[model samples]
Target: MRIRPITRDEITELVDDLWLPFAGEMGDIDEYDALAEDVDVRAEALDYRRTQLDDDETQTFVAVSDDELVGYTTVAYSESPPVFARDSGAKVKDLYVAPEARGEGLGTSLLERAHEWGRDRGCARISLSVHARNDAARSCYESMGYETRYVKMDRPL
Candidate 1:
């Protein structure tokens, strides 16, 4: 498998594969279904990713095997709040590997690339959010040395 930064012309292809991760999340969390119902997700995702193509602070990477697009990740540079000790950090906005590609380590490879990108930009840390109930993903992240730094809770009124 080869991993590289995606070009503008390939944004459509990347967007096409986005549903794999989205569907997975929807299946793993009930809240995502409500979230999806509230927006035109496909169009919104396409528009957002398109904007990242020309933004220096953001990056999108794709993994291909046998000339077929299989997985992707998007990461961006972020500034910490004034109360935080760190001035800047890297946030992994999204990371998804196709179901058929899960056991391969594509996720780890993609995350390593994100780490390299953040390090190059002089980021003090890297962070990402994961659904509380997604055990598979949480385990994968934990194995990669990611720790839970905060929790967000909600109750319906």
Candidate 2:
């Protein structure tokens, strides 16, 4: 298995692979289902990724095994607000691994690449969001030394 920056030719496949994670989220959370019903997520993701392909501040990485795309992650650099001590940080927009590919360390490998990318760009911190109910993902991130810096609470209307 290898993890590398996604190529233009592989964008469609990457978008297609996104369904695995999206579907899981939709099934696991009511909010995700409501949101997905309101938008064409696949198209939005494709366009979002395409725009980042040439942008220096953003990067999308894919994990391939046996010539098949198995996982992906997107990271972006941004400056913190004036209130923060750190000037800049990197945020992971998305990260997913296929069910069959889970437990093989693809997620960690992809994140490690994101770390390298952020470090190369002089980012002071790296951040990502995992759904509150995504226990597996939260556990994995916690094991990797990620700590929660904020909590987003919602009261459904």
Candidate 3:
């Protein structure tokens, strides 16, 4: 497998493909339909990510094997909201490895490349958020030396 920076034209396909599994994974929850109700919202979100990719502050990397796209990741400077304390580091916004590629080290390889990209930008830390129910992903992150720093809880009103 090999890792490289994402190309400009690959953004749409990358974002769209990742959302498929993401939505499927969350479909088990009752709130998923409500959250995914607006198709336009999905398009807008992809557009937003496309725009961000043009910014120097954000970077995306892809992992390839046998000339096929196997995994991809996106990292950016952590945003600091005035109301909440945020650390100064590169925040991994997305990381996805094709289900068939899970056992391989593609995810870890992508993350390591992200760290090098962060270090090149003078970032002091690397962070990411994973859904509580995604135990496999959580375990992978933990095994890679990541720790939980924050949690957001939700419930039906």
Candidate 4:
């Protein structure tokens, strides 16, 4: 259980596996409206996420077990936290532990690493968005001492 920097090869390997399912669990009404405007906005965002991982600004980590990629988390700053927090904050852009990997403290380890990554950047705090419907993840985050500071409002725009 080492927390380390994500290499290019690791990013490419994890992109297809982690991005879309995470994207599908967004604020529904907002995603729905955006789909009406252009069906590919979510796709574009996933692409952008991968690109950000490739860029210098974003950082990521993975939980490797027995030489297999099992879990991952990403952190990004320099414009963060959805404006709910001030600048110089870091956002947990992604966190996922495969079904078999959950409950082993991997998520917590990944989160701790992400926050450490934030602190290393001189960030004031770390933040992330969880799906309103994902009670399990919400609970996990809450147990980890993260509170719901902002509710992403959703209505037909």
lDDT of each: 0.84, 0.86, 0.78, 0.74
Q: Model 2 over residues 48-146: C-alpha lDDT tens digits?
A: 778989898999999999999998889999989999776699999889888899998888999999999999999989999888888888988998999
Identify the leading candidate in terms of lDDT: 2
Model 2, residue 120: C-alpha shift (Å) = 0.4
lDDT of 4 by residue, 1-69 (tens): 666776666655565555454444443433552233546655675566668767776887888887767
The better-scoring model by lDDT among 2 and 3 is: 2
- Each model's TM-score? 0.89, 0.89, 0.82, 0.76
Instruction: Select the stronger candidate by lDDT from 1 and 3.
Output: 1
RMSD of each: 2.0, 1.9, 3.0, 4.3
Tens-place lDDT per residue, model 1, 31-128, is 54444567776788678878889899999888988877788888999978999787699999888888789898999999999999999999988999
Q: What C-alpha lDDT, on a 0 to 100 scale, does residue 145 get in candidate 4?
A: 92
Give residue 41's lDDT in candidate 4 (0 to 100).
Answer: 55
Task: State model 4's lDDT.
Answer: 0.74
Write down the worst ten-residue block by lDDT for model 3: 29-38
Q: Give the clashing residue pairs of candidate 2, or none.
A: none
After TM-score superposition, what is the CA distance of residue 80 in candidate 3 from its true location, in Å?
Answer: 6.3
